[model samples]
Target: MLLQVRELKVGYASGADVLRGVDLSVGASSVTGLIGANGAGKSTLLKTICGFLRRRGGAIAFDAADIGKLQPSQLAAHGIAYLMEGHSVFPGLTVEENLILGTWAFRKERARAKQAVERAFELSSVLRAKRKVKAGLLSGGQQRILEMERLTLNDPRLVILDEPSLGLSPKLVHEVFERIAQMKADGAGVLVVDQSARHVCAASDHLYVLRLGEICIEGPAASFSDRIDELVRNFI
Candidate 1:
């Protein structure tokens, strides 16, 4: 597995548990989907796995290394990339500049950075056309696309996304999910959390349903197709 999270627990400084004994796994070529309602601790799980939040208990292993106390930058260096909600990007910078920043780990290697940037451009011709434009000026969908492209610089082994479809039109949401699926095809493990359960089910290889800070159900994506409606109604 590229990422393995076993009985993980986390909470805020306020001392209330946000995640309680969550278990999840992602393989190098798998697309895993996590679906839940607003307060189900989905975002907390993502943050904790990426090392943005401290874990109160349990373990997180990425590429076979325990990462319970690693910092966010360290996790990224260890081949994990997180594309947070809001499709965050450096709005004031040009597309190329933002991509260069994504190559932070290899900044001293100018030739390698250049090649990585070229690969990013190849992901979307739209990005190539707007390579000189400020990121803030692109349409919302374009900005989201740019955010995904940035992950290419690191060529990460595992990719985590939170609500990638948020604030996007239906077509844009489909496109974004398609890009995530492509990551799996390219041999990168993907762990995605989204509110759109139907969309997530369609894109995932495995599905996990969380309710009240716990996993209520988990199985291969196809196994839940028949129960998706009822599952969403009861758990999501």
Candidate 2:
């Protein structure tokens, strides 16, 4: 497994537990989907795994190393890229510059940086056309794509996405999932959280249905799709 999370528990300063005993894992060759309601702690789990939130208990191991206490910067240096909700980009910077920022740790690797940027451009023509434009000027969907492109430039071993498809048209959402699928195909593990159950199921190799901060059900993506409504009704 590229990432392993076991019996994870976390909460804010108020001491109200948002996540309770969550167990999840992602592999280099797979797309792992986590689906749930608004307050089900799906995002919290991702945040904790990436070091945005401190875990109250349990362990997080990445690439066979215990990394529960690492900071976000350390996690990024260890080959984990986190795409927070809203697909945040450097609003003032040009798309190209934003992508360059993604490779800050690899600033000395000139050749590899160029190759990564080119690969990001290959994901969508909109990016190639507006490479010099300020990221804030792009449409919502376009900004999301740019954010994703920026992460790709980092060449992360594990990519964690939180609501990548939020607030986009159906077609644009499809494009977002398509790009996520391409990530798994490229041999990077993907841990995705999306409000859209159908899209998540479609993109996932393994599916975990989270409810009240716990995994209520889990199985292959195809199995969940076969009986999604029934499972969603019972668990989510």
Candidate 3:
């Protein structure tokens, strides 16, 4: 496994526990889908794993090392890239500028950075055409593409996403999953939490259904595909 969470638990101050004894894993080069209803603690689990929130109990292991104590920055340094909900782009920076920032760690390696930028542009021709335009001016789908390109630039070992296709059109939603599928194809482990069970199952190899902070069901994505609607009404 590339990323693993065992018997995880989390809660906010003076509030009911948001996650309860959750366990999930994402294998190298595979996509794992986590689906749940609103307030089901899907995002909370991601936050806990990335160290944005403290775990009340259990463990988090990434690439076989215990990383439960690592902060978000340290987690990123360890090859875990998290794309939170909403458009995570700088309104002021141009598309190319944002892409360059993604390669900042390799800034000294001009050749490598330039290659990464080129490859990113190749991933989205729209982005390439609008490379000099402000990211905020791009359409929502295009901005999502830019973020996708930025994350893949570092070749992170694991990519975690929350609500990746929330407000996009069906076509754009498909595009988001296609890019995520591409990330898996490129050898990155992916753990995604999304609103649509059908779409998630389509892109996932393994699936975990969260209900009220606990994993209620889990299996191969194909196992859940047929009952997607039922699952959404019941599990989600």
Candidate 4:
């Protein structure tokens, strides 16, 4: 597995547990969809794997290395990238500057960084058009695309996207899912959590239905699609 998460648990200092004993694995050439109701620990699991939330128990192993103990920056160095739920771009920076920031974690390699910027532009022509404009001025959908582009900048082996389609129109949501399909086709391991079950399943190789911080059902995405309406209702 490219990423292995076993019996993970997470909770705040004084709050109830948010993630309870979640286990998940993603292979190098697959896209996994994490679906569930609001506050069901989908985002929490992503955060735990990316080292944003401290795990209360269990382990996160990536490429045979224990990563649960690493800091966020260190985790990124280990080739894991996280795209959060909302627009994460720097509002004050130009689109080009925001894209450049994605390469900050890379070792000083001018050529590679430049190539990454160009690749990001190619992936989303909207960013290319507004490269010199402040990222804050872009539409919500465009900002989300920028965030995904930033996460892919380092060519991370595993990418975790939290609600990549949140609050977008159907047209924009379709575009986001298309990009995700392209990413999987490029052999990137992806773990995506989204409220839109049908769209996510369509793009995923496997599906995991999370309920109240625990996995309820998991299987091939194609199989789940046969009963997607029922499954989505169960999550809600």
- For model 1, name the residue pairs that clash: none
- True lDDT of residue 177, candidate 4: 85
Once fitted onto the true fold, the runs of candidate 1 whose alpha carbons sit more than 4 angstroms away are: none
- In candidate 2, stretches whose alpha carbon ends up further than 4 angstroms from where it belongs are none
lDDT of 4 by residue, 112-149 (tens): 99999998898677898999999999999888888878
Candidate 1 lDDT tens digits, 152-173? 5778888999999898999999
Q: What is the C-alpha lDDT of each candidate?
A: 0.88, 0.88, 0.89, 0.87
Which residue pairs clash in candidate 3? none
CA displacement after TM-score superposition, residue 175 of candidate 4 (Å): 1.2
Clashes of 2: 0
Q: After superposition, how far is residue 99 of candidate 1 from its true place, in Å?
A: 0.8
Q: Highest TM-score: which candidate?
A: 3
- Compute each candidate's TM-score over C-alphas: 0.95, 0.95, 0.96, 0.95
What's model 4's overall lDDT?
0.87
Q: What are the per-residue Cα lDDT tens digits for candidate 3 across 75-98? A: 556878889877799979999999
* Candidate of highest lDDT: 3
Model 3 misplacement above 4 A: none
In candidate 3, position 161 carries an lDDT of: 93
